[model samples]
Target chain A: MSAALVVLRKELLDILRDRRTLLLGFLLPALLAPTLSVLVPGWTADQREQPSPVAVVGAEWGGDLVYGAQLEKLIRVVAASDPEAALRRGAVQAVIIVPPDFTAQLARGRSRIVVRYNPADQNSLFAKQKVFQAVAKFSLSVVEQRLQQRGLSRAALSPVEVHEEPIPAGGGGLVLSLLLPLLLAVWALTGASHVASDVGAGEKERGTLEALLSAPVARPALVIGKFAATLALALASTFVAGMSQTVVTALAPAAWFDAAARPALRAGAVLLLAACAFAIAAMAAAWLLALSFFARSMREANQYGVPLLLLVMIGGVAASTLEGVLSSLWLAVVPFVNVVVAMRGVLFGRVDPAALALTLAACAAYTGFGLLLAVALLRREAVIFRA
Target chain B: MKSARVLVRAERLAKRFGTFAALTDVSFEAREGEILGVLGPNGAGKTTTMRILSTLLRPTAGRAEVAGADVATSPQDARRALGVLPEAAGLYGRLTAREALRYAGRLHGLAGEDLERRIEGLSALLDLGAFIDRRCEPFSRGMKQRVALARALLRNPIVLLLDEPTAGLDVVAARTVRRALAGLRDAGKCILLSTHLMAEVERLCDRVVILGDGRVRGIGTLAELRGEGGELEEIFVRLAGAGSVV
Candidate 1:
């Protein structure tokens, strides 16, 4: 066997024996997307279905006109002298303050109604929406009644009828298209980061690097072996995360899929996604391994690794949010962003094959550069013999 | 003695780390069937010389060869000819002693029955049979050293470079390592040992190379260095310089 293969086998075996790495590299990624997909929607649905408690300061003063029967059913009206205090303390989701002359003011022209709710609180925000809808409906009813008295139809108020015709949804609807690429970028970098440090700096810290270097193996072979191990672990994590997310998207209710995207699992699409994932994983592993080689110990590797990960994650988020990002050929040259943009394009059926090929080529180039840098660093006595 | 070929040779090796000169000028040779002790104190360039021999570091100037392979021109070949037991050599804690030896053997291109056979032979040779299958995490300093020794010898290297091989072992463990080195010397393997301990030199070295401030002060057998009969310590102190003695 080649020395690189031998070294790779030993490194992989070492990683397999580590329980912490196993948990981080495999188990955590497998559970991550499924947990978020299932739990978050389920929790949000429950919140939506349950009526929020709202405090109305002057319910009697409004005489059930402003607080109509339909509106009252959507929220349980609680009594409170200090409605604002109640909202702050979570005693109520929202506070609706109706003035004493609310009906009188409505007769004259318009009435002042204030809905106080915390925007930071989900339940409070939902309550505010419901309460505002009810008040608006009451005002519309009053306007319609007055219009009827004056022999005018509601059409008199709505002179121009605005018709909303949504453009046919493209790419795997907006949410899945954007979210999948972000997940891919995150897992690829995260998975590689987990093992790069251990494989590179951990070996030095444990004092095994010198022994390994003393072997008959070439320096490039040793580095390639270690790089392969790190890439394997990274690819494993990335693959698991992608598969989990795909399964979630497939199993999720159709209503959850935004736009026209609805879990389209074409062979070509799957292949494209797999290609994007592999490219991302390869680039991440090589970059992180290079950084790991530069570090003197595992602690220093982490200090370097975490920031790189965050920077990549931030780039991924930026790519996901950038409108029409896939159409731009310039993004195809950026490392993590290009992968994310390509993934989004693939998932949404907006793929530009030329752009994707460019992205792959760019990632390949970066990976090659990173591997070369790692090999060069490994050959440097100052780096290898660092205290 | 004249027929015994030189297996390890260093000629005018001078190394520097930018402004600091670690080795100014040093030369030595170890022949088959003998232990050559390179004696020096801390910062005496003992480790640096061993590192150069092991192909871990490059000498700034001069040349070195192991089993006829020049370390500078052909490091991989030089490494293949060497079995290096570095100072405070460490083991992979998760791997068993047997596994560690197998890994080392595989890297050297030994596999299948031959690799397993060599592992078994070294296990008996170093008395690693008791804990060969156990993880090295809880092994004592002596046990780890023995495992390291087994790994080094697995390649059947032409030249064995040991840097402070028994520096931290207990008396019993140190005796075991010393016995193993003596047996390897009798087996006709050239052993280049580096240490500052006078007793270690007195016990095992066929010839001593006394180094001070990266320069060789004396190189000869104990009897030859003693000349008119003197304590080895006094001679070492005098040759190596009294102020540099550790």
Candidate 2:
């Protein structure tokens, strides 16, 4: 154990001193989550705050429909002789063309208002939504006017009323639940990948493996020490990412997320999330280290690492999509997927002790298996001293 | 010679990579206070023998021992008593000589003040003072060899296995290493020196073992081989099969 610790200390110091490894494994992962959290919401807010430009064709005949409503305040309405050209030139997000018989159709109590906008353009899509809402409001006001003329109640227009009630609703925290698992997995992978390859295959290529193998230290101790250093890096990255994400979520404008669905960021929940992150990091570090040892060179190790990274990403994506099935105990036994599910459960203030225990136990088992494989590989002269 | 204690002993050691034999029925011994030179041509089994003795590679047939510990069964103990300088002598380019030595010392279970003192002693012995604190990246080949030698010697093992220690060094650097090995031999350390250079063997080795095609060609003192009626070069060329090619 002591020998392992010495190796761990040496590896950690070496990795920390290397600027490239430090940047890729530690610095970048910590900064990415916070940067994205702030930038994405800020950009969304900016887009919403800007007035979308729209061209009102046949405004003379449809002046009441466009100008009478409060939509003009939110959208910039312009008169364009060639509205399609204006849209193509990016001058307008949408074009509202009123047919010459629009008033006649409205007088007959049913009018078709064609709203054309580029679906590929995000601003155009936003403008289309805004115009649709304004037209619906105008149609409602017209119906109420007709009812008043007929001396009847406005309720006659809608005989059946539909209401939507979400089950166990009122928490907008689902967005965080969906995003946190994927971020943690990414952080764990990025943190462990470079360092794992450097320590394993890098040592072999540098001709240091023979010296290390010739030492009095047992293979198990050496493997454990290396794994410890890798785990430390992985945990540090995940911790930074998780903390940054939490801080960003807390400081972000409430309008950016569902106010009702926003999870209560309690200390207990945060602690649980941190525990899950550590477990996932440990498993990932060990697994990555094992894979790296199979490589004969640093370049080869990186090549092997790419598949593990892709696996993590795929697992994260699968977990996010499978959130509805998180209650399954079987998923808690799956490696990367389990960590994501358990983290989602923790964030939503639901702590299933059996599932958490299973996930933690599974992670521990995988970590042990990975370390054993690494140690076994290290003992083989063909693997350790591969030319 | 019979009374001298044997620190490194190999009895009919053999190694094979697939069907190709790297070392076959190779046998040799190095006594304390003596340098046993392993002379071989290219692709001979000198490195294979050295690797077996260092416990880096297990012998396919036959047994080897370092400081009385069986290399195959108790590699950790054998490793503790053995110091190896490989042909490449690769160093971590980013580490200073001092740092590298400390790391090697720690791996050998030397720590704290003992590790520091060992590093200091080795630096002084190897004349590493000028560049000991600098990263190994800028060091010349000779300097890297010296650092590698210091790392191997840090544990002060009873047996030293050096493979082509002076292979790529200039004349002055090679002489420095030969002088150091002579000094170590005089200090009663057993050293196994593997190389293709006859001059190094004549200068430092008390006994020489010549290998050819993974087999032992001849083993004796220079006087014994000379008594066989040929110069050292002629005897080596004939026994190592280089004469046939010429």
Candidate 3:
């Protein structure tokens, strides 16, 4: 164990001094999350705040439905002789056509409104949504007016009332939860790839493996030490990434996070996230180390690592895209997927202790298996002395 | 007179990579206070023999020992007693020579003040003061070789295995290595040195083991093998056969 610690210290010192490892594992990941977090929200806000113009046909016959209360504040309604041409020419994002007899039908309590917009166009889509909101409000006012004329209470317009309330409801945390797993997994892979390949295949290519093997330290000690260094790097990178994301989210405007619905960034939650990140980092580092041991050179190790990284990324994406708790017992033991699910559960304050335990146990098991494989590979003369 | 104590012993050691025999029935011994030379052509199994003694490679058919520790059964102990500089031993390019040496020392159980002192001593002994603090990446081949040699010697093991230590060095660098080997030998360390240069073998070896085609062609003192007037080269060529020396 002492020998392994020595090896770990040396390997870490060596890796830290390497500019390539520092850049890829530490600097890049630290910068990526904050940069994206700020830029994406800013861009989305700009898109949402922009005015959406729409063209209206038969404006005289459309009556108050076309010029309803406060509609002009949200949308710019323009009268166009040829609304389709105006829409196609980009003069308007959408077009609303009113029939010539639309006033007669409304007096008899019947009418139809046609909304035309290109779904593929973002501006058109936004315009369509604004028009729909205005129309719905106008229809509600007409119903209230008719009820008043009949001398009936406004409540008589509806026999039933419905209200929606989400379970474990929150908004700001939703984005963070959706992003944390993928970002952490990516950081883990980035960190592990840099250190694991350098220690495993890079040692062989540089001819340093023979000297290390000839030392009094056993092969398992050497492997464990290298594995520890890689794991440390992996965990450090993920922590930095997670921290950057948290800081960025906290600094963002309340409008971006729905302040009332944002969950407090509590110490217990942060600690749980850190624990999950550590488990993921350990699993990533061990697996990458094992794969790299089979490679004869760093280049070959990178080739093997790319596929594993892709697999991790896909698993993270799949988990984040899944709705609800993701507390299925089977998914709790599925490596990277489990961590993502557990992270989601933790962020939303709906954690299933049993599932989290299973996930952690599974990660521990996989990490152990990976380390054992790495040790076995290190002991092989063919691998250690590969030409 | 005190009997010579053998520090390294390879008894009928053999190694096979699949069906190809890299070393066959190779046997030799190096005693304390002596420098034993392993002389061979490029593909003559000299490196294979050195690797087995260093506990870096396991022999297929025989056993070896370093400082009385079995290389096969107790490899860690055997390795603990051996300082190995394999052919083309490479350094961590990102590390300074001092850091590299310290790392190697720590691996051998040296630490703190002892490791630092060992590094200082080796840096001075190998004339590494000029570049010891520089990263090894931009080092010349000769400078790297010196650092590697320093790393191998840092632990001061009972047995030293140097494979082609000066194979690609300039005359000055080669002389530096030869001087270091002589110093270690005089300090009573058993050194097993493999080389192709006849001059290196003639100048340093107390006894020479000439190998050819994975087999030992001859093992004896130069005087014994040279007879009354034969040159060491002629004897080597005669024993190892024609077209063997490169």
How many clashing residue pairs, candidate 3?
Answer: 0
Q: Rank the candidates by TM-score, best first.
A: 1, 2, 3
Ranking by lDDT: 3, 1, 2
Query: How high is the TM-score of chain A in each model?
Result: 0.89, 0.89, 0.82
Give per-residue lDDT, candidate 3, residue B224: 83
Candidate 3's error at A175, in angstroms?
Answer: 1.7
Best model per TM-score: 1
lDDT at residue A280 of model 1 (Cα atoms): 88
For residues A110-199, could you state the per-residue lDDT of candidate 2 as single tens digits? 887788999888889888887887787788888899999999877898988889774553221766777777788888888888889888
Against the true two-chain complex, what DockQ does each candidate achieve? Answer: 0.80, 0.67, 0.73
lDDT of 3 by residue, B1-246 (tens): 027898888899899999999999988888998899898777788888888888778899989989999998999889888899988589999889898898898888888898898889888878899999999999888888889999999998878999878866789878988998999999999999888888999999999999888999999888888876688888888887747567
RMSD of 2: 2.9
Candidate 2, B1-246: lDDT as tens digits: 667899999898899988999998988888999898888787888878887888878999999999999999999889999888987687877778888888888888888998898889888777889999998878888899889998888998888989878867788778878888999999989999987777777898899998999999999888886775877778888888765322
Q: Each model's TM-score?
A: 0.94, 0.92, 0.87
Q: Cα RMSDs of all predictions? A: 2.5, 2.9, 3.9
Please provide, for model 3 over A1-387, each residue's C-alpha lDDT reduced to its tens digit, 9 standing for 90 to 100. Answer: 298998899898889988887788778887897666554865676555655677878777888877772355556777677889888887888888889999899998789979899877877887887788888888888889988988986689787889966554542276777677778888888889888999999888998888888888877888889999999999888988888777777777766655544456567777777888999999999999998898989999988889888887788778745434544688888888888888878887777889888889999999999999999988788987776
